[model samples]
Target: MTEAITVMALRQGVYDHFREEGDVFEIRKEDDFSAFWMVKVSDAEALALQKAAQRQPEASRHVVDTTVIDNSELEGLRIQLAEKNAEIERLTRNVPGKQADAPEKSAADVLKMANDPTVEFMTFKAAARKVLGDATPSTKAEIIAALEDKATAP
Candidate 1:
């Protein structure tokens, strides 16, 4: 069997995609500030992980380390991580809610999002605020025009 590897310091966007795919991954660490994660995988899966990481828009390259553990140990680790995650969520459930973060987007990015045929008013408004730091125009055409203007600005 191929050796297992641990890929460290992954960006949050990348981790979000991986978190849903339960097979072939075990998250070992997470940092909220930089949104970095550490995950365990087989060397056999490392190439696929690298390709997936490469697809992430704003992530840096990750360093891989050898991970030595028997199957039982790996399972134990996953169970522990999941329990910790559940407990963390439970403890924080009563805290005041904050707005969900919009990914770091530029005017051009918001313009591209605005161009989506299915873009909703509230979605565009939130994206516009993130990109433009102000209220978005009320109408789609106006938002598109404003985004275009920003995209073309010096």
Candidate 2:
């Protein structure tokens, strides 16, 4: 059963009943610009009313579908990233301005390159290997003699 009560006509007992029985009946306030009525509804009636409200055109206008995925932009970005990486590798191949086919350095040139402060350590090691047949030299004089021998050799 359902009943309608006005805010002006509501008694304390109605408030007490609703407080003690938590939402056993759904109450909705209806107003037509003049008077308001508190209408009590059953559970089934409340569910039906809610479903009807969701089916209204005004409710559908608030929802948007945004589930579309575009992979072309992502693929284009990946291609551009790969091209940039390749360009970096190509530019760095001759980074020290040395060519792969440069002629082998003579003993005097090797000694000069080894003693130069601005040369990289790898060049010093290469010179040592060329003169001493090993990457390390025990004494500075031994390396110097070895370089002089190679310089005088045919």
Candidate 3:
């Protein structure tokens, strides 16, 4: 039987970077436990990548050990990982609830506000004030034209 191996790291980015480097792997992000990458990598390659990742400050705390286990042994480990992730999600959800009463702004609303002509004009006027200060007629006309073009563009 092909041996199953699992390794954990501090950040998903490290795993993603390694995967992108042509490594054959399956990665899963867990909210409770550290994120992991599972693969059939040669022991040398795994150790090398683990050490390299550990050199970075953010990934230094990662536990970069691999286990050799039967395929059947993974089912229970997967289930437990799922349960732990669910619990982590639940706890994280509660944290944001405390701040929910604060005013919330959607991305669309912010974009619309930014695109408002009055707001755009104010921004342009402020920038022009800094660059052109007491603007000449030519500079004023240029600013107006630029602002109009920005306002009209999709």
Note the residue pairs that clash in candidate 1: none
Report the poorest 10 consecutive residues by lDDT, candidate 2: 18-27
Give the top-scoring candidate (TM-score). Answer: 2
Whole-model lDDT, model 2: 0.56
lDDT of 2 by residue, 22-110 (tens): 12233333431122223455557666755765676653433343333358866897999999999998987886535566666678887
**Tens-digit lDDT track for model 1 on 40-78?**
456667668667766864323333322545789889989
lDDT of 3 by residue, 30-77 (tens): 332233433345667776776775675653333542355567778889
Give me the displacement of residue 78 in model 3, in angstroms: 1.0
- Pick the lDDT winner: 1
Regions more than 4 Å wrong, model 2: 1-71, 96-99, 120-122, 130-132
Each model's backbone clash number: 0, 0, 0
Question: Local error of candidate 1 at 65, Å?
Answer: 50
- Per-residue lDDT for 70 in model 2? 58
Q: lDDT value for candidate 1?
A: 0.61
* Each prediction's TM-score versus the true structure: 0.34, 0.40, 0.22
Candidate 3 ranges beyond 4 A from true positions: 1-68, 97-154
Report, for every candidate in turn, its global Cα lDDT versus the true structure. 0.61, 0.56, 0.49
